[model samples]
Target: MLVRPHRSRAVTAAVAAGAAALVGFSSPTATAAPVPGTTVATTTTAVAAPVTAQADILDRVRAVPGVTKVTEATAPEGYRFFLIDFTQYRDQRHPKEGTFTQRLSLLHKSDDRPMVMYTSGYGLSTRASRSEPTQIVDGNQLSMEYRFFNTSIPTTPDWDEELTIWQAATDQHRIIEAFKSIYTENWLTTGGSKGGMTATYHRRFYPKDVSGTIPYVAPNDVVDGQDVYDEFLANVGNDASCRDALTAVQRRALGTDRQWFLDRLAQLTKEEKLTWTITGGMEQAFEAAVVDYYFAFWQYSLQSDCADVPDAATATNEQLWEHLDAVAGMSFYADQTLSNYVPYYYQAAYQMGSPEPYEDRIADLLKYPGFNTAESFVPSALRPVVDDTKAMPDVDRWVRLRSTEMLYVYGSNDPWSAEPFTCGREASAERRECYRFYVDGGNHGAKIAQLPAPERTFATQKVLEWAGLTDADPVAKKVKKNGRWSTNNQLDRPEIRGRALGRR
Candidate 1:
């Protein structure tokens, strides 16, 4: 249960860098690994003659408008992967305003097969890999980079005007619409964390685009912060000792052991040959790291590890540093890490809300309370971007009243679970089409395969029906295998979601 997901290395690289968010059946053993490709011009090879199925797919990829480049990438058996570049607008409202090449990765099976479109929250690594939904549904996958991220940057960057959630969803709508002419079968959208939220936003704006959506650990966040996370942290690990031990570690690391932690940061930076570029110096970065530790401890660790966390005051520097590094990466706050995640911060500040810092828990320990760590990293000119309070609430309302064929998954230990998309409806009802499941001991990389076996079977069956692939071999093979899987995670059954606050 040790998930070393330090900023996913570079956004959610499709099943490949997912190589962070990519899933391989069970457990959160995913990380984003970088893949290389070029943005060359592309044109459609008209499908006048019906050739082999593989050849026809290439023609369809070319036929899709705005597709500038398509190059083959390594893939697992039975799948052909292509890295694509599509020239998209700075703002969908104004066609002539400008354009930038957005990254797209397609994993093809056949025209008649269902397709799963991944809504990534970060830059697209464009590598070939299937998400949880794609794997279970056994469908082709299309992974697109979010607008203004990595290679998808706007020609004229304007975070305030161009980087809104609606604009990003429109980018998705454009791609999905273009692909509709070829793949007439079922369609589904899925992603984890920020990517999961991206999928939900796409559904909110264009619900009918896909037959269903499966968002793992996605949050429909808003405004300054949500108190749900604070409560989660307070009770994380489901053991009072585990929760107290975590905060105690933070206190010692930031208080009496402050200098020791600083020295370790400097030494590790030099050892790794990395540079620091956070607004505040390494000290402030240290402070941020300690504060984020409350989350990292549970989001990345397991109940077993909680017993191993060194006593902040009693353990040797080596013991403390080992546990710290295991939970949080040393180079997470590095220059390149910040550069890649700057877009995430901008979106969080402008539209997608982030969890407020654990101020009540560690306010006095902080050296820079007024300075928002990630939000402050945004350019000074972009400061004072008003919170879009309506953004999340509108989606939440639509999800409850109008949303259908949607599924949500969360890990009870994941801090992001604090503010899950909450429209409490059951699947047993005829009208309700949404369902949520929690991985017993899962972390941020939770998967449906990890859900308590009964839930896992039910979820996959629902997913198969939704994708119109009812004939797929879900129950025929895995019934005996799932029975042996453990059900209990040794933690209190914390509620998976809370009332996502509006402006708290």
Candidate 2:
């Protein structure tokens, strides 16, 4: 860690005021190499590093181990943004092995402020924004893209070996190690869906890296080889009205109204200009989308109210397709999407558990008997070997017996909530520093802010107490783009996105 003193209250207050009052924080009288493509109107004062200009601070950042490249962007109102490229070993166990670069973005509000490590399941995003945890506390955020994602890939990748949870957690460990030297303060981590799992994995391997973590809607399969999610969807909300309604739609599309929907699928292919060869032609994509409908319904909370369901038997082809498309996007099976998410499916097939079959309700409707949704995505070239019983169960064991200061959030109706992480039946008796909250009928997009009173207040209070903060005001108000807005980089924050959907 860099050897420097913590900024005084006066200095921190001055720095937060504006660039003009950035007294010792900016290098007013020093000469340092300027950063390329970096126009830093203000620089963060890492508690231990020399106070430098925004650009020089980045220059210093480049010197941090694992940080290969840094470039700044115009940030949201009161924040500064930068995209970073960090080098990682193919396997953390052997540094002598080959290396790869993983990409991450930073949104800095101040140096002394607590920082939230935001984990993203996708690499396509280059946006700078605050997370639900960050916004609640109005803190800085370091959003890192998962390894093997589009923006961060090893040149000669081996999906089977390099993408282990331990290695990925180490990828995060390296980042935390490097950045702590600068922003030396309490650190917290958070992610939703797969990203939430990613955060929990890091906490498992390197528990002390962050003060607390909130993993949202993250499923923890027992690794007993059971696809519990199927059971969850089967009885979600314990209300069959909507499930029956959706199943009726599925049956009509795949059973009675099959040919017409097939025609619509072809027409959609032409109109949307999508390719299906990756998933084996247009007809195959149709089958996948149709099967995906029921799962997607609860996964995404497609029906806000059960009364909205159109009677499948009486609904027109257009109505069926609209409802089908909303729940299971027709384009979800597109060539590019399938190709981009190859890593996601690979992870699922490997250490992460893949979904098990629960299609007895529509067994006769399926033409492809053993069509594997995640398996099909793993190209023969990747040498896929699925083991649903490896990674998560161990993580669960750890969370049950060892994890502390961890908060879990979920939607009661979100399909992945089937196996939400738990702290065992003795949670209160054990005095564990862990919490679990499920929105009444929330979906994958559930957030603590959306939770009812005291539970939400308690969750926020715990996170605040963890970060040692008292409030979350003064945060740049998250806003939506009405076309005229300059950017739409907001990641699934509830206030900005109507739905808190995470990665597909």
Candidate 3:
């Protein structure tokens, strides 16, 4: 019923050591005027375009077939938004790298104000430049994890805890550089879900580049509670009985009923009023399984101990760890490879079927990569960093930097929100150094805030205030009916579905 959803830093001149090595590659600049015709791939580079003509070029492109939304505006004196297009190659190593084009909007709010960059996370299905590009807010929540899922270099060793941490940090630095190159100033950054966690990472890494940040509905305790897969197995069985049945199936499959488990799935699809096909059904089950497994995996990774369960004893950290490890073994991604499910599944369901071949592919991926996880839709050249736990020092340092100026918003109804046992409130006072917005009955950043007009008004007002756009109280004139955040903005009217999530 209620909708749920869901940075940094800089480098030195290396003491002016080696400019050749320092400047690996530079992106072609944009121009105000359109270039004639479609430019084909070529060995010779295209000349840089002028910024003055960027709007005209965009207008011409908008008129082309299949072209979507095109917008051009001189961002206010302090803030500016620009849309750039570039063909992204998944594998820098591959001669024929698949093409990827993305739009980045920059807001340089004034020198006094901070530059705030929003990362897409609500599953943006369309490019940022599309006519009907997804809105910034989805399901009343702002995405905070775009850098990890969308913007960052995809090269990462998925299973190597240390490497993932390292690559994440490296990507974090690159993200800051990207921002600085475009905006030429320090900024505040945020997003939701993927964006949220990224916000955590950003604060964890590039603290100096950002004045503040807001991580909405993001879970930061990835070392423990961020397990979506295994946790789902333990919870989303439709009910306790369903969970029990699934657990039984998992146990049986481990023993003698593997074929039976597969057969039952087919039977359910054919006989029951099942909306999902065998493939789809398996996907769902796998997702739930992954969530649960990840939880156990965290225990093992963090505690560095296996779980043990007696015949009559309840599940322990050890048993779950073993069970999850088994699942990891079965899944090709368990090997040190890239992160995220999309690319891994892409290879499994499409390129390679056998787990062994897939493992080899993953190993190859470790050599050099671009923007892809273990299994990539496109090959990359950037080497995969396997053990990056050393980056933790940088992460913790950055986290402290942004904590002072950041605001973290979370929904109680969201499964990913961090809720500690010691503090029952949305967030503890100790954690409140950074403002944390807790929406009652809200899931992710959905339309729930609209139920009451006062809340809606407050949200709008707060956003504007945060942006340093206006000082007018959106709901100052409205009487406080019950002292709860209320709003008259129709956008907040609970009846309407506020926003939908997208894949960026």
**What residue runs in model 3 are displaced by over 4 Å at the alpha carbon?**
1-49, 53-116, 120-124, 127-188, 208-211, 222-261, 264-402, 419-433, 444-462, 472-504
- Model 2 has an lDDT value of 0.67
lDDT of 2 at 245: 88
Regions of candidate 1 where Cα sits further than 4 Å from its true position: 1-5, 8-56, 269-278, 359-361, 370-373, 425-428, 472-504
| lDDT of candidate 1 over 1-504, digit per residue (tens) | 001124422223332232111111111321111111212333433335434435656766765666666777777667778888776777778766656667788988777778899865765654466676776666788888877655466534667788887998998988888777667888899887777888888989988888889988876664446546667777777688877888887777778778888888888778766555534466666666666666776775677878787887688877877766555544565554554555676667767777766656677887887454446655444566677778877887777777788888988887777777775555446776887888876777678888877888888777777888654444323533453222222211322221111111
Clashing pairs in 2: 445-500
Model 2, range 1-504, lDDT digits (tens) per residue?
000001111212222232221111121222222222222222331233434545455566655656656778878677878887666676778666666656788888787788899875645246566778887666788888777655366555566677788888988888898888677878999988877888899999999998999988887766735657667777886678878988888899889778899898778678766676556667777787777777666766545656677799788989888877765666565664455455666667676765664576788988874464566655566655656465777898999988888999988887777777887656645456888999988977788877887687678777777876643423222211111112234533333221113222
Global lDDT of each candidate: 0.66, 0.67, 0.33
lDDT of 3: 0.33
Give the alpha carbon lDDT tens digit for every residue of 176-242 in model 3: 5543433343345666554555555556556665545556655443122123423432342123543
Report the lDDT of model 2 for residue 434: 85
